[model samples]
Target: MSSSTLGYLARRAAQKERVRILYRRALKNTLDWAVHRHLFYCDADELRAKFDANKHVEDLDTIDRLINEAEASYEKWQHPDPYIVPWAPAGSKFTRNPAPPQGVEIVYNYGKEESD
Candidate 1:
């Protein structure tokens, strides 16, 4: 358990963590472009394949480089407009009361008649 060996292990662990975080972010970003469940499934599968193809590299230097490259590509191709939940406060459909169409009459008057 030399100091140098411990440092190497720590660095390797940090690199692996960075890669995992990057992969999760990339997958979430893919959801921005795929609205439907089927579309998201297909897109996610392709993204997984791309990541799996590079999973065998044991060299830390190459792993760091690959992570940097992936991050750059993700930034470049990020969706300009991502979908927001309709019920979320930031979404366009978020409202306590929606506006009615123009020229439509809304009546709130009620009359009750009782005859015996």
Candidate 2:
């Protein structure tokens, strides 16, 4: 194989790794939010008692429903703003006026015009 082919494969692998990392992070964040919202506030001992009372049944339809609702709420909270503002402190050297990229060039157009 040529060096350029190897380089292309390497870049593709790196890109896939980055995408996997982002997906894992997003999943972790969602799960953390769901658990924190649903179970973290409740007393663990009480939860254990409830589980024991139910004989540790794996049929958690109710719990699943509650968790689904919590996940929806978490999604709402996560994307409150369409734009993500920087967390940099005021007057920080890195804190500059945040704006979208000046000009975004589309490398491979996907059945859409450049202006579109």
TM-score for model 2? 0.31
Give the root-mean-square deviation of each candidate in angstroms. 6.5, 19.3
Model 2: residue 82 alpha-carbon error in angstroms: 22
Residue clash pairs of candidate 2: none
Against the true structure, what is each candidate's TM-score?
A: 0.72, 0.31
Candidate 1 runs further than 4 Å off = 86-89, 92-116
Which model scores highest in lDDT? Answer: 1
Global fold similarity of model 1 (TM-score): 0.72
Error of 2 at 19 (Å): 1.0
- Model 1, 56-76: lDDT tens digits are 988889988999999999999
* Residue-level error in angstroms, candidate 2, position 8: 0.4
